[model samples]
Target: MEIEYQYHFSLPRSVVWKYIKNERVLKNALPGCRSFSMVSNNIYKAEMDIHIGPIQDLFTLEIRLDEDQAPSLIELHIKGNGNMGQLNGQALLMLKENQGTTMLSCKANGQVTGALGLAGKRILDSSANKGLENFFQILEKEIKRRIYELKRRNR
Candidate 1:
């Protein structure tokens, strides 16, 4: 399956890039994430509880940052396995600054196998989209909180 999304953040591109690369922020933003840790440079291992349609399972995911261009672009490759299935995917994220706002565009392509694959493309797409939306909402809140804390500390 393939998915694409675009989002605008009220913060500057530099700030958005910093938060996006922070492990703490990502762990908090991901839905159902049990653990997220860096295994090596640009590589991370994560355990998450995933529920998609009628399937629910605990997945172990290996995420690799394949390419990075500072505050502009990032490419990621992911591999995951669970009792329900196996998942492999790649994603590209691009960020552009407009005024003080940061615009993010993401494109992801993936394939699923086993029981999860039986859930069909429509269900998978819907679930993925919902998960992304939830992630972004939580991420926004986390970023704002961090910014507030920084300001308070400097005051």
Candidate 2:
């Protein structure tokens, strides 16, 4: 499956970058995340509970951030397995600054294996497609609220 998402933040690219790199923020904003911890620099171990239709499972995912470009671009490679299936994806993200704000965009491609894959390609694709839309909206709102609080503190 493939997905693309974009969000605009009323903050500088630097501030937005910090949130993306911070483990706590990432964990909290990530949809379905139960626990996420930094395993090594730029690598994180994540535990999440997700459901598609009536099937639900907990997955332990290993996520790596690559293509270091501070405040500008990033690549996320994730792999995981659960009782339901195996999941793997690569997401390329770009951050651009306009005025004093930032626009973040991501393009991702991945696959599902095992039982989850049996959901039929259309079902899997639609689930992921709809999920990304909802996830991005929620994530952007969380970060925006955080940034607003930070900006308030700076005053």
Candidate 3:
């Protein structure tokens, strides 16, 4: 399956990029996340409880930053297993700056095997889309708060 998303942030590209690279910040963006921590450089471990349709699972995922190009681009690989099944995916993220705002775009592809896979494609797509939207909403608020703090500190 393929997933795509785009978001706009009022912060500058550099600030958004720097803040987003932190594993802690990323963890806070996930919906129903239980725990997220770094294992080594560019490698992260995350646990999340995700619900789709009538099923729910506690997933343990290994996330890796496959490629990074500063404030411009990043690529990620993720693999995980849960009571429902297993999932693996790769995503590419790009950022563009116009004036003071930043535009972020992401493209992801993944496969599922197990009970979760049995949920059907339409259900998976809608569930994933809703999850992504929720994640972005929380992330945007966090980023704006950070920007506000930084500006206040600089004053």
Candidate 4:
């Protein structure tokens, strides 16, 4: 499966980059995430409870920051397993500043095997898109709130 997502933030790229690196913010942005913690430098563990159709399962995922260029780009590799199936994927994130806004984009490719994979491509794609939409919506709201708080404090 392939995943692509893009979001625009009114804040500067630097601010966006800083916020994204925060574990709390990332955890909140990921849909269905129950717990997120750092295991080591640039490596983290997360547990997510997801329900698709009538199936519900808790997945344990390990995420590694494979490559990064501060304030500009980051690459992540993730592996996850659950009673439903197994997932492995790599995602690349790019941040670009234009005027006062920051544009963030991601591209990911992965394989799903086992019960979840039986859902077929169309169903999986639709589910993935909905999940992405929900994730970004939460992220945007948090980013705006944090930016507002920072501005208020600096005043």
Models 1 onward score TM values of 0.96, 0.86, 0.93, 0.90
Q: Ten consecutive residues with minimal summed lDDT in candidate 1? A: 63-72
Q: For this target, which candidate reaches the highest TM-score against the unseen true structure?
A: 1
Write candidate 4's Cα lDDT for 5-100 as tens digits: 888777789888787767888898898899998999989999999766666789999999865688799999999999999989998989999999
Single out the weakest 10-residue window by summed lDDT for candidate 3.
65-74
Worst 10 residues of 4 by lDDT: 49-58
TM-score of 3: 0.93
Colliding pairs, model 4: none
Query: Which rank order by TM-score, best down to worst?
Result: 1, 3, 4, 2
Model 1 TM-score? Answer: 0.96
Backbone clash pairs for candidate 1 read none
Using TM-score as the measure, name the better of candidate 1 and candidate 4.
1
Candidate 2 ranges beyond 4 A from true positions: 148-155
Clashes of each: 0, 0, 0, 0
Task: List, residue by residue over 1-155, the lDDT tens digit for candidate 3.
Answer: 89998888777889888877777778888998999999998899999998999989999999998556777898999999999999999999898998998998989999998999999999998998898888877887887777788899999
Model 1's C-alpha root-mean-square deviation from the true structure amounts to: 0.9
**lDDT, residue 26, model 3:** 81
